[model samples]
Target: MRKEFDLQLDSFMLHCDAKHLSKKTLKSYDQTLRLFAKYLDVELGITDASKVKSSHIRLYIRYLRARGKYTVASSDKGLKVNYPDRREDYKKDISDTTIANYTRNIKVFFNFLKGEREIKENPMDTIEKIKPKRRQKQLLTPDELKLLFHSFDLTKFHEYRTWLQCRLILDSGIRAGECCGLKPEDIDFRSKSILVRDTKNGKERYVFFGHKMSTDLRRWLQYKDRFSDSPYIFPTVRGTQLEVNNFKLSVRNAGKSVGLEVFPHLLRNNFAKYYLIEGNGDFVTLSRLLGHSSVEVTQKAYLDFTDKEIGKKYQRHSPLNNLNI
Candidate 1:
C-alpha cells in the first residue's frame, strides 16, 4: 500500500474536488504536481513526500529554469506520450508567468500536505512566491474605437452581434467570458445593469452600461429575436450560445479590416482607463464596476498611465485651472 505521504497528492485533489473548484484549475494543479513528482523521482530518486526536502525543491526550480521551452513535456497524462517525440524541438523557454503559476500550484499541494499532517516538516517553508512582471496592455484611442465600431458590417448577423457585444464590453467592463455567457434575461432594461452570473472568481456581480450602450443593446435584442429563438443574447447561426474564441476572432478580424489590432480585453482596459481619467479618477467605483476583488488589484493592473494621459487628467483637476486664478 502507498504510504500516507505518497498518496497525499490524491488526497489534496479530492479536497479540491470537494471544494467545487473549476475543472481548469484542478487540471492545472494535477499537472504541476505530476511534473514535480517526476522531477523528484528522476533527479533525487525520492518516492516518498516525507523524504522530500527544501533543497530538492530548489533543485527542481533550477531544473525548470534551465530546461528550454517545449523540452519539458507535460508529465500529465495524454501529453506525456508526445514528450519523447517532441523533446528535441522544444526550443521555446518557459515564460516567467507560467513558471510562477507552476510554483504556486506546487506550493498549494505541499500546503495541503502540511495541513493534513501528512508530513512533519513542510518543504515549501523556504520557498518564496515568485512575483512575475506585469506586462502593460495596449488600449485603443477614442478615434480608434470609433473606427472599429464602424468597421463591423452590421447587415450580417454575426457582425451585428459582435459589434453590439464590443460596445457592451466598452460600456461595462465585464470580462469577455462574462459577456459571452450573458442571457437575454440577465439584462435589466429598466435599471440598465447586467447581472453577471458567470465570472472568473465564481462570484456574481452587476455591471452597468451607459445610455448609448443601452440603446444599442435594446436595438440588438429586438433584431436578434426576429432571427433566433436562442436564450443567449448573442448566439451562433444554429441559435447556440456564442463561443468565446469565436467572439474574440470576430472582433479581431473587424479590427484588422480597420487597420487596427484590437481584441476584447483591450476594450475592457480602455473602459477602466476612461472610467478613471474621465470620471474623475474614481478607483473605488471602477473597482466595483470591473468586479475586481479589491481596489489594489485594480490599481496594480491598470495604474500604468502614460505621461500624456496624466497631463490630460491633471488639466481637468487643477484647482487653479478650474478656478481661473
Candidate 2:
C-alpha cells in the first residue's frame, strides 16, 4: 500500500486506474509518482496536492539528478537483491531511456492536474530528458554462436528443450513475452509459419523460419511428447506457460556450459544484427520481424557491425567512417 500523506498521489493514482492502464505501465507510473511524493516530502514540506507548485515539481527533477537517480548503471543488471549500496554507491542508476520515461509520465501527471484546475502551472511542462548516447549493440560472434549451440547435450530432454527455446528467440526475434504466450495453434505445419498475436505495440504479424528453426522445434517437441502435454509450444515443467525468470535461469545455465553468452537480450540483438547484415541492412523488414514500431527504433537498437564491415557499406554515415551509421 502507498503512504497516505499526499493527496495529489491519491488522486493521480485513482485517475490512472480509472483509465485502465496495463499492469506494466501501472507499475512504472506508480514508481515515478511515489518518487515525486518522496521529493515533495523532502523539499517542499507539502503533503497536500493542492499546495504543489511548478517550482516544487521542477525541484523534484533536480533532486533526482542530484541524487544520481538519472545515472544509468555502469552495467545493466549491475547489483543483486538484498544488497545495500554504500553512501558513495547511491541508488542503482537507471538508464537514459528510463529517465525519459519518468519525465514523460511526470509531465502527464502535472498536465492532468492542470486540466482539473488543481495547479496554477505545470512544472514538468518544459523539462527534457538528457538524450542517451548511442551505445554499441552487443551481439554474439560466429564462434560464440557455435560455442553456445554445440556446448549442450542433444540427447538429454531438458538440454534439448532449452536449446529449442534459445533457437526460437535467435531465429524469430519475438519479444520474451511473446515466447511465453505462444500456443500450439499459433503455428501451422503446412504453412511453415508462426503467427504472433498482439505482440508489443499490439501489432500481430506472421514470421516464418527456414529449415534450421522449424526442424529443431519439431524434433524437440517430439522428444517432449513422452513427458507431458500442453497447448503452449513451450511449456514449463508443470505444463503451464513458462515464466520469464525461469527461461532466463535456463539460458544462463546453458551459457555457462557452452562458455558463451546466451541471455535473451544478447540473442535478440544477434537476431537483428544478423538479419540486417544478411538482408543488406534493410530496416523495414527487420523492423517487422523484430516487432519494432518504426525503422528508426530498429536502427537505434542494433549497431554490432565491425568497423571494416561498416566501412564496406556503400552509404556513408559519418565523415570519419565515410558512411552513415
Candidate 3:
C-alpha cells in the first residue's frame, strides 16, 4: 500500500468496491498486487504503474522461479525477519500451482485495468495458465477417525481442550482457522450448530455438530470461566484469542496424543467423505454442508472418494438368479 510502487492497485480496489465484491476477495487482490509491487521494486527497479507491461510480469515469474520457495525473502528496505535457515534448490523452475495462483491474481488486476481503460488490454490473456498436475485426495480411514477421537480425555484440563478442538474440527468440517476463530456465543446449542464466519469464499454458514460433540462441548463450556474475557472459544493462558501459528502447534500436539497423524483439513475431508457416502453420494447436501460455492468443488474432492464398487458384487451374488442354476 506504500507509494513507491508502479502499479496503483487502488484502481483494482475501486473497481472491486463498485462491483460489491466481498472484503476477503478484495484483500486477496490487494495482497497479490502489493507483493507483485514489492517483487518489482526488489528485482526490476520499476516504480511506475503506467509502464507496467507483460514482460515485467514474465520477469517477475522468473524471479519467483529462481528464488523459489524456501528462499528467504529479504526484508523490504532492510528490515530483518528470523526465518529458519532451510531452503530447497528449485532447479526445475516455478511450480505450476504457484504459477497458477499468480496468474489468476494478476489476470484479475489486468482485466480490471482494461475494463477501466487504465490499460489497453489484459496482458495475461495470451499467456496460458500453467496446468497443475493431478493430485489424489487423501481420506483418513474410519479407524483413523476413531483413533483421532479416542486420543483425548475431557476429564483433565489439557486433554479437555484437545478434545474440544478436535471435536469441533471433525464435526463441523471447518478450516482450522475458522475453528479457532470461534467464540462461545457463536455456538447455537439449541440448534446443535455453530457459525463459521468468512469461510473459503467469505461466506458465513452454520455447521451442525453431532450428539457426542454437543455433550463434550457443554462440559468444556463449564471451563469457559477461564477464557471469559476473550471472544474466541479457544484462547491462550494469557487470555488472548489464538493465532494460526499457535493453533498449528496445538493441533499438531493433539494429533500426537492420538497416535494418528492428523491435520485440520484431513478431519474436514473425513466429514465430507463420510456424509457423501452416508447420503449415498449426495452432492447437493454435501456441498452446502462444507460451505463450498459449488457442488463441483465438493465433487472434485469427494467424488472419487465415495464412488461405490460393490454394485457389481451385489448383482453377482443375487440369490434369486442363483436358484435357476
Candidate 4:
C-alpha cells in the first residue's frame, strides 16, 4: 500500500487545475514537483510519499544551493548535469528567493496530499518557510525617465504606442499584463479611469490616470483609428493584441538607448514610490489601486523606502519643519 510520490503530485496538479489556477502557476507547480520527484528517486531511491521525511526536504534545500542552476533531467531522473557549458555562462548561485518559492510550492503540495488522505503525516509540517531578504527596489530617476521617453521616435506607431504604454503604467500603477490585456471598451474617458477586466486575481477593478494620460490616450486612439480598427488599446501593426513579453522587450531596449536599466515592472514600482512619497498617498487606497489582496501586502512590498526618499517624505510632514515655530 505504498503511495508513489509521482502519483501524489499528479493528484495535486489535478486539484490545482480544478481550482482554476492560472496556466503560469500550474506550469510552475508542475516543473517544481517534477524536479522534487526526480530528487526523491535519484537521491534517496525513495519514490513513496509516505516515506519522505523532514530531513530529506532540508537536504533538498542544501542541494538546491550547491547545485546552483544545475538540475537533473526529469525524464531520466539521473544525477548528472544536463547542460555543463550553459551553467558556466550563468554561474550565479541559486537565489534564496527562488528556493523560498520552491519551498512554498512543495508545502502546498504536501498540504493537498494530507487533505486527500494520501499521506498520514505531512513531512513538510515542521519545515519552516524561507523568508527571503528584501532588496531595495531601484526606480528610474527623473533624468533617466526623461531620457527614456525622449528616445522614442514618435513618427513610428509602435514607438508611439510603447511610449504611451510606459507612461500609462507609471501614472496608473497597473500591472504590465493587465495593460496588455486592455481593450477599447475598457477606457472610461469621462472618469479618467480604466476598467481592468483582466486583472491578475480575476477580480475587476478601476485604475485611474490624470488629465495628461487621458489626453495622450485620446490622441493615440484617434491616430490608431486611422490605420487599424483593432479592439485593443495597444495592438500589433497587424491589429492583433500586443504580447506582454514583446512590450517588455521594447521597454528594455528603450532603456538601453538611454544608458539605463529598466523594465515594465520598474515603472509600476516607480508609480507606487512616487504616489507614496511625493503625492502623500495612503497605503489602503494605493493597495486597492494596485489591485493587491490587502493593504498589508502593499505595505510589505513598498515599505523599504531609501533614506533619501524617507528624508524627502519627512520634510513634507515634519511639524517643526512644515510649521513656523
The candidate maximizing TM-score is 4
User: TM-scores for all candidates?
Assistant: 0.81, 0.74, 0.79, 0.86
Q: Give the worst 10-residue stretch by lDDT in candidate 1.
A: 80-89
Taking the tens digit of each residue's C-alpha lDDT, what string does model 3 give over 212-318?
Answer: 88887887776867546666677765667666556666666677787656777777777776665544547787788888889888777765542343353345457
Clashing pairs for model 3 are 6-47, 6-48, 6-49
Cα-based lDDT for every prediction: 0.83, 0.71, 0.69, 0.88
Poorly placed runs, candidate 3 (over 4 Å): 1-7, 11-27, 70-95, 149-159, 253-261, 279-281, 306-325
Residue range 148-257, candidate 1, lDDT tens digits:
99998899999999999999898899888788889988989899999998777667889998888888988998999999999999889889988887898889889999
lDDT of 2 by residue, 120-140 (tens): 777775565558776577657
Q: What's model 3's overall lDDT?
A: 0.69
Q: Model 3, poorest ten-residue lDDT window?
A: 82-91
Candidate 1: give the clashing pairs. Answer: 69-92
Q: For candidate 4, what is the total of clashing residue pairs?
A: 0
Question: Which lDDT value does model 2 have at 27?
Answer: 68
Better of 2 and 3 by lDDT: 2
lDDT, residue 298, model 1: 91
Task: Candidate 4: list runs displaced more than 4 Å.
Answer: 1-6, 46-48, 70-91, 226-229
lDDT of 4: 0.88
Model 2 ranges with Cα > 4 A deviation: 1-23, 38-92, 115-117, 153-159, 256-262, 303-306, 312-325
Candidate 2: C-alpha lDDT: 0.71
